[model samples]
Target: MTVQPIIFFPDQRLKQICAPVIEFDNALRTLTVDLLDTLRAAPGIGITAPHIGINQRVVLLDLPQSNMPEIYINPEITWLSDNKKQNEEGSISMPGISAPVERSVTIRFCYTDLYGKEHTEEADGLRSICLQHEIDQLNGIFWIQRLSALRRTRLLTRYKNI
Candidate 1:
């Protein structure tokens, strides 16, 4: 698996809504591997296909506490808890910046695996937050957008200066 180059924030491709993955084939498997490698190299907890300029619905997430990375293809949030939690969120595309973003404390999501099997899973805490963040990327929502407008502006300016 190759560690692909990350397309940083403000790139037009990052704003393009990703297309669903239709073919569960070797290419898809390769993309998954590449994403995992890229995320690991990014030293990040999560990443999405569009971050690397692949406009397909895919995400890789591996919290440091997890046994292994998770690859989600065409992942969609199915349910969200009424309760909310705030967690600091960063991005592989927009490195070195983070802010607390409010999200559901728990979520249920459906996704396809590399083998084409559909799976639904429930998550909470960091897993829940990371999944939501990655899915947002697949939907053309940058993580910074999750922040308050004032925070988003300040962070982007800081990112630009970096």
Candidate 2:
């Protein structure tokens, strides 16, 4: 149960893109476990390796509706629906800050599992929103960037007071 420290927002590392995981070894497994512990500690539904300053393209999602946590190594969105949906999105990096962000209604993505098995899956609703959010983090895009300039400023001000 290693709950790694999360890198908070405004940190340049959070905006830096992560490198793909090349070795699916014990270290990778350990990192995934640490990520889960950190996510649970943060009380967030999703997290990425970069959140902990690892700079690896790994994501762990434990949605409330999920039976178990899912790991996505080097995850990438392969397709997106034309339709869009607005959902409240936030990040563990910036706790106590949240805003409604528009995202694709459905998404098809591919990722490598812990065992190095490649898999593709499609998701919608909250699951879809989460996947896209985490992937964006992996790509060095903070969730707040999806917001409009005015809304982002207001959210930042609120976060500053928190």
lDDT scores for all predictions? Answer: 0.90, 0.94
- Give lDDT tens digits, candidate 1, residues 1-162: 799999987898988889999999999888889888888898888988898888999988888888988889899999999999888888888788888999999999999998889999999989999999989888888878888899988988899899
* TM-score quality measure for candidate 1: 0.96
- TM-score of model 2 (CA atoms): 0.98
How does residue 41 of candidate 2 score in lDDT? Answer: 92
Where does model 1 exceed 4 Å of error?
A: none
> Candidate 2's residue-wise lDDT over 32-75, tens digit each?
99999999999999999999999899999999999999899999
lDDT of 1: 0.90
